[model samples]
Target: MTDSENIKEIKKLGEEIMIGGVRFKSNVLMAPLAGYTCFPFRLMAERLGAGSAYTEMVSADALKYNDKATTKLLYTDAREKLKCVQLLGAVPTVFERAVKSDLIQKFDVIDINMGCPVPNVIKSGEGCSLMDDIPRASKIIESCKRSGKVVSVKCRIGMNPQRIVIEEFARMCESSGADMITVHGRTRNMMYDGEPLYEYIALAKRSVSIPVFANGGIDSKEKAEEMMEKTGADGVMLARYGFENPLAFSLLTGREINDTKLSLILEQIDIAEELFDELYVLTYIKKLASYFMKKQPGTKRYKLDLYKCGKVSELRELCTAIFGSDDNAGLV
Candidate 1:
């Protein structure tokens, strides 16, 4: 692609749009990542450049029962630009209640997790296994749509690698009242391995009029552009790569966000401290610090030291020493 063409595509990515009656500031979004995507992380992604960000998948039954831990995961505030929750479950009735529940009703969008490849989730007949049962998955989507929120689905191309179901599954999501669909370009058996089949994602986009967001293996502007060009997808959902570099939205769209991973890490620590106990804050930041410092020189030592931090102050001190002094440690 020419330089001008690349620029145009990047411009298109960050452009504002109306998806499911909700106005977003950009098209690039932070796909939900388990153990991450907490309120602080989502807020950071949005501030950095993501048009929207999703909460880690909340279990429908847990929501219905008002599980405290699950409810806490739904935390958000005015700082967030858009609120979205990804629900994981198999029972349509449970999904119906979860969407209507007070905890979930505040969000602008509800993305159903039909693509998660975790073994436990699959065994429960939820996530990717739902693809094997079309009628049930359709009912779950319909149920969530009734709540009046813009409902979306994230799913793999197929359950078995032998046969890809991108087109058929996407149509099912749309016809079942999903306002949008995200096709993770991999099968259940493949998990997160191999190259994402660009052609299958293209088939899904062609099959549905609703906006299609392609997920998997997109970590940079070039890959994002390639995914859009190959699949004709409306947007790209940055999952693993997104959390690894929360500034992905800014980087991918060429947005001028004045944030270094260090600064963002400190900011996350502050937000997490307010909502969580000291122990929780310390442990979470330690894990997050590893992601920020990934592949950097002396990263192994930093990870080891972070885990040893018994106090949040110690973790903060370690971060400042490691990244604050470095100045230009991964900026966006």
Candidate 2:
């Protein structure tokens, strides 16, 4: 392909749109992982070209009752311009109040958490457990829509192997006034272990008129491209793979995954330093070092040293020694 053709292909692959007037510049999104996807991490992902980023799932009940820790998860940096907050709860009133709260209004989008398969979430009749009760789930979506923010629902295919109800549930979400829907192709019972069922996601996509984003097991650019082609999804939301490589967005858009790795690590470190103190920076660096070590040679040794380093200066020295220079550390 010619240079112009390559640029066009990249643009096509990284296209964006406005859902309920909220701007999303790319189709690839960073999924909200429980302990990850904090403000600093979201900002780093956005900077690396994720079209959108969501806060890890917050409790609707906790937000309504003013739980300080839960509220903290809702916090965002100024650079997280395309922010979406994900809320998990089965109670209609709590979910309603949480979405209507002034804090939630600060976000560009509000995502309902119906895909999480954790026991705590499922036991409460929230998350994936809601799939068995479409009426209750529909009511929750209706309540969220009343909050006046763009409402989106993220859900798995079903509760177990015998129940793949994504198409029906997705249709219900649309009928309930949800602005968009995200379908993680694994059933609740499958969790993260098995291959995602793309056929189920395709069914959901066909059932909804609003944009449908496919999620689950998208770890590499090749897999991303294949999923989009196979399911005909409007976008793909990435989870664990994003934590391991923030620049997976650029890679999915057909960018050359060369030196961009180091740049993103430094960028994340800078963001962490600005958001918290040196101690937080040290912690983030160690976490990030482990992630990067997965791909680079002798990374296990670097990760061990990173974990042992107590000071930011020590971590910086270790990074310099390993990466040589910081010139090529950003996203491609």
In terms of TM-score, which candidate is strongest?
1
lDDT of 2 at 105: 82
- Residue pairs in collision within model 1: none
Tens-place lDDT digits, model 1, residues 21-123: 8987787888988888889889988887888899999888888577768878998778887899999999999999888888988898999999888899999
List candidate 2 stretches off by more than 4 Å: 1-12, 65-67, 254-259, 277-279, 325-332
lDDT of each: 0.84, 0.79
lDDT tens digits, residues 1-332, model 2? 32222221222457776777777888888898887777888887786678888999988887766675676678775667787999999988888888878778888788999988989888889899999999999999999989888989999999998988988999999999999888999989888988998878877877777888889998788788777776778888888888887777777755444545555666667777776678657866787667765665554656667778988767777876666645325432
Q: Candidate 1: misplaced stretches above 4 Å?
A: 1-11
Best-performing candidate as measured by lDDT:
1
